[model samples]
Target: MLDAMLPVILLLILLYVGYTLVYKTDEPKKERKIHEDTQEVKEKHVEKPKKHVAKRKNPVETTAPKKQIQAEHPLLVHVLKGHTSAITACAFSPNGRFIATASTDRTVRLTLRESLKSKNPTFKTINLPYDYATACSFSSDGKTLGVVTADGCKVSLYSKFKTKPECITTFPVEHNVLSLLLNDIGEEWMTTLTIGKDDNTEIKCWNTSGHLLQTVNVNQIQNYHGVQSLDNRFIAVAAYTPEVKIFEIQRAKDGSFSKLNKAMGLQGHTSGVTDIAFDGSDFKPVNHIVTSSKDGSIRVWDINVRYKLQEDPKCIKQFQAPSGYYSTVDITPDGKWIAMTQGSALYFLKVATMQICCEIQNAQDDDITRIQFDATGIEIFVQGTTSRIIKVYHLPIE
Candidate 1:
């Protein structure tokens, strides 16, 4: 019986050891299965989210074509490259077929219209040397070009050189030419290149035939400089003796000049006169005179009454420059943009709202000397110091 009890205890110990070993092995299997189930559930949830994802369309790959800009609001299309030196002056021929640019390079170029598609559309250059060109214009027929010299104080007339330009005639003037104009038919006018110590202001008129038509003398004014004539009947003159003056100059058969019997004079600029532009189309939006001064301001006035000092020339608008002394200023023919040079920078202001448009920052540093719009108001040409080339800008039509 003792032996039987010992065997039973030994059996009980073996059973207990077996139960412990089995429980430990099964516990590991159970935990592994639960972990696997949890992993599967997590994977299923992640896969569900992926199946419900929304696709996105790329903006660069849009299906519809973009709308084009309108004609009245035409966009800028950069075209021809311009001058290499200080561009003294620029103008578009009345026909808009070519652009004339005058520079301290002592040359003027006739830039042809090339398709903007071309990567390079440079001007077919024509060489004309004046002492230094300050003012320039194309004859109405676009056949001749006139440029004033800074040193020689003369007017050089250039005719087309095989559809390019060639200097055909030159006339000597005792004074430097400050301003000039040639009408649709080559009718021309010129004013002081040098304000004389004589105190007699001189503005001369000529015809396409190269005949002197009138000589205007204004002893009362210090330096009479700009002459702009319309329809060959009405003449506008801007002068300075530290003051802005406008006088009506009349031409007679004897080739004599006289201030309008009853004239209008304007005085507002605090410094010497820099520029004046006449916009016949904007006769009402602006006065006949828009003058820029070293004082860094522009004053627009209606000197239509200047012959009569008692009659006030309407001070329509005044725009100030952003920085630098006002070197030069011009208004688009339609009276849209007023561009002025301040030191080495170019500042453009919208006439309608007097808004500053842009300060053209070239990767290459150059002083922006002069700015002018094309005849059709489509482009701007600029030049200045350290300038090796002229920049032509395609502009907005609106």
Candidate 2:
């Protein structure tokens, strides 16, 4: 009986040990599942804030569309943009029906003023094969176009420039031509040359046939500018000297150009003169001439004096630029306003008061090369050294 009881006790003890081992193993798996569930909840909580942060940034991103609209100038009327390279010179026809432009791209373009606002503005291109044009002018009748070339210093005349273009003649000049202007009848043209090998500034007159009619030396080092009166009687030149020299262009008995004689000198500025302009295109006796100088002053002279009687030209009004020198100046066709350029800025002054009426700062991207008014004086055209586009502005004179 004792042996049978010992076997039973041993079996019971083995069964209890097996049950305890199974229960302990099942408890740890439950604890691991609870820990994994808590970690998943925490991860979901962290992702919600990231989505909220992205939603909060939507308002700031909506403001970027405002920059798409560019502001345009109030006075700007038209922007002519067909030149492929920098424009060197530009001029309006005498009648204001056409505009002529010369560019470094070795092409001269003629455009109608009426078609400037069209979608495809028509441009008649005149190719310069040998060199580029440095300056250009129109005949009094607006039928002939005169262009000055850079290489060889040549003057080219074009006939029927309005419809069919023809290069009638191109002649070599003696000196480096600074500016060229055709007379009222278009038979003769005048050019101002820089200091020549003879150490003189030369003002030369030539007929369309390329014959040198007359040459006058200004006894100066550099010839900066030259312009003729509308009546074709007087030529005013600015040079390295402060005094502006006025010359009378003599004509032959048939009204053809013959020679030029020194008339008088305008003396006032302290430094070299940079540019000069006549008052208007129609002058009964040419009463006034405007000049700009390195001395930073624009002087209006009463040129109607009797210089033959040895009466000196008088400076009636003097306007000093706020800073820097004026590179170019032009009086309106009505002689009511004076337009000038200093650096890249443009200014308009009332002729009566000599006060600045309007100022357009940064009118060009670079130095302003030329500023001109239309025949009607209602529009102003501006060209720049590096900017390829020509700007046309409607003057708010009223």
Candidate 3:
């Protein structure tokens, strides 16, 4: 009986061991988990293409950065060549139909804007009474022309609309005229003149008839370029010492105007301030002044804050140029763009962001003496000083 009981107990123990091996193990669950993980990876791969398609639908998001990149190659529309010597100054007619260029060759040429390349274009060529015709400007109606010369400190007035200018009158200045600007209406003008080979310069205000209205001594600052505001309410002079002197145009109740007094001084440039421009004001308030310097910097000043801080007028915007020595600067009529010259290159900057819209490298062989934008801001005229080449460029529209 003991042997039989031992055999039965052994058989029961074997059956228990077999049941534990078949049902108590976790291998199937582990295999199912691995298969689920592999399915999740496959689902991820299926969703990736949908995300890529979403990105492809919005190409503008990728292409928007291209707008900020300036044009590497500038489109040159025309090159004008008629001057015998270096072109000293240039001005665009208010109507945008003509351009007046003065040169050291003792000649002032009025070239038709539409036909800059025509050999027999509609133009008026006049010989200056002196060898150096330093600067020239046109009246608002495009009826009168004003020219300043280095010899005898002479300021000559001429009438337009003819094949040749008819001398209206000549005014004598006390010093060599360096810069001249006429008001928008042409009722008044402003000038900066040097004093007898000295570094001393004076700022003068004159009427359209060549009568001196007021004068201020700017000898301390070496002011070389002066411009009147669009409303003729202020005069700004760019100093070689890297400063801008602004004077308010005051009017008395007695119907007489008073002499200019220093209203504000803008100082930021590390080198000489080469050129200055004001807001063109198309029924909008003129509140800013733009300046370029020889130190390769440009600044925009707020006139409202200038009155409060005359010693150091506040600059709202500042930009470092790609190169040094900006010779000239001009703002568009709508205050949208700034056309500036750095060496022989011409640059157009968007006014809002100060980002370069486009640049024309090697625009000429020599330095650019002047740059002016048309009333519509669709065209720009650039003149190389010693190169004696005038270039016309069509501004890119957004």
Candidate 4:
């Protein structure tokens, strides 16, 4: 009788528990208590309002890092390696503190510009991609960047940040923009005078707002490519061939561009033109134009005579590029010296005698492609074939 009673009691307890759970549910999910400050956003539950939550933002928000990898200019500074393709052009910032390089790698780089015999000032390197960037330049203010593309008919302006640059606008080009320039005032800009496949040599002038202001047509097709001057009074047209043709730029009352006169024409190089730069007009008496050619020669033109379209410049001087294939040529802003490249070797020539004043014996090497000076003309920067560091050279400012 006891054993039977024990079994009966266990069965009754199990049945009671099952009935309580299965048939006696207390409340629906709607009656469940919720947190007072909880909220939902994009499938995420927030226990506190956005104002109460700590906001996360970087004080120095970095932009998309350009695809190239390299440190800024180093103390031993081997700074830039260009794409495997030929690097086209390079420029220094207006303040003489930064360097910008353009290459066929479809990207450009901005780095601190430095110059020293054995110790280079440190600088940061950051790549900027413009897809097919053929060349890049900084305005006189160092605030805007102008990019020349290979296959495009426009010059792209990028607003430069401390770490990178942002594309501000694209100035539609009349021809393939072999080069782009900003005037001294930073108000006007000039594009390349290119010989189009259609047998036209046109230069499209524009303002910062992307408004087309004027178009000047020349007689034949040519590439006035390389360095351009921003003097509101003169336009330097570095010809596709080894010739330097200059024009007088007169801003008419209507704010249009018109050639006042063919101010100068220089012809001395046997090979194609490589690069050309002008010293400051404030240089002693007359300004000078320094040019480099593929034939490994650097020439200086005295822009003292205002020539007609077909005439020649009155005074000119020439120098031999270091014994190698010359790739680039540049001049300091104050018009004191010239810098040109032959492979990885860089040569600095004095403006007065055009003598080799200084040489970075190994700037780029046979693998090196381009070189340029800072706006203040104290340092030399280089671009190498697949080298992150082109090369940095600091010369004693004489």
Tens digits of lDDT, candidate 1, 1-398? 89879989999999999999999999989999999999999987784543665779887787777889544212334433456576666666655666776777777777765533466654656565545677777665566667777787677777663455666677765565655666432234332222332255666665444556556565445543454433323444444544554444454555444334325555667766756666543123324556776777786665555343487777788877655466566666666677666665555677767777755444114655455565555566665555545556655445
When 3 and 4 are scored with lDDT, the better candidate is: 3
**Poorest lDDT segment (10 consecutive residues) of candidate 1:** 189-198
| TM-score per candidate | 0.60, 0.81, 0.71, 0.62
Model 4, span 1-398: residue lDDT tens: 99979989999999999888865564333333233223324337534455666777775675665688554323234445534565666776766566676666666666554442225444333344545665677776677767767676667777654655677777666566655666544445432232232334555667666676567664434654534454445666555566566666665565555443556667667766656777663223336777777777777766655454444654467776435646667777677777776766666777778687666655554556556665555666776665544566765456
Name the best candidate (by lDDT).
2
**TM-score rank, highest first?**
2, 3, 4, 1
Local distance difference test scores for all models: 0.59, 0.80, 0.72, 0.60
Query: Where does candidate 1 stray beyond 4 Å?
Result: 1-88, 103-106, 114-124, 128-135, 149-154, 161-167, 183-201, 207-213, 217-242, 249-262, 281-288, 303-310, 320-325, 357-365, 394-398
**Between 1 and 2, whose TM-score is larger?**
2
In terms of lDDT, the poorest run of 10 residues in model 2 is: 189-198
Q: What RMSD does each model have against the real structure? A: 11.2, 6.9, 18.3, 21.2
What is the clash tally of candidate 4? 16
Q: How much is 387 displaced in model 1, in angstroms?
A: 2.3
lDDT of 2 by residue, 103-198 (tens): 998999998888888998777889999689888887656777888888878888886756768998888777777778777544443332222322
Ranking by lDDT: 2, 3, 4, 1
